[model samples]
Target: MSEITPELVRHLGELARIRLDDDEVTRLTGQLDAIVDNIAKVSQVATPDVVATSHPIPLENVFRPDTVGEVLTTAQALQNAPDAAGDRFRVTAILGEEQ
Candidate 1:
């Protein structure tokens, strides 16, 4: 089993800028040791022939084709605007900048 010492935990806490009490450090030592042991077990089972994958199941792009479809005209789009210029929507100037 991998050993997670209190000194290691204290060093890690300092590096991460986290304050861990003595009780927390003691608890984390056992938890981190268990995690490392599990990882070691997994490494033993993972042979070179086995392929690595991010997900258990296969994945593919599910997006629809980008085909051009019927769209609204400028006049139709600007019809609901509170203020409209020649061919676009108009809004109040921001940041004290002149248009």
Candidate 2:
């Protein structure tokens, strides 16, 4: 198993844009070292024949049926706008429209 030293911890902290204190660096070093050892064990047993899968269980698409509903009235739609154009809702001029 490869050891995670203080140097490694400092490098990781730099990469992650994190400023770790002495206690945090020491704690993370031990945790990262253990993770590396466990991953090494898993890698050693994983062979070329083994296929990578995104999910463990079967995924089926369950989609809802398309349906229509009643539309809102002009009065309801214009109620939220700060400045409305009569019965219709008015908005600020779009940036790129031509005369």
Backbone clashes in model 2, listed as residue pairs: none
Candidate 2, 70-97: lDDT as tens digits: 8888888778889887886666678776
TM-score of 1: 0.58
Model 2 TM-score (2 dp): 0.66
What is the lDDT for 52 in model 2?
83
Off by over 4 Å in 1: 64-99
lDDT of 1 at 26: 94
Clash count, candidate 1:
0
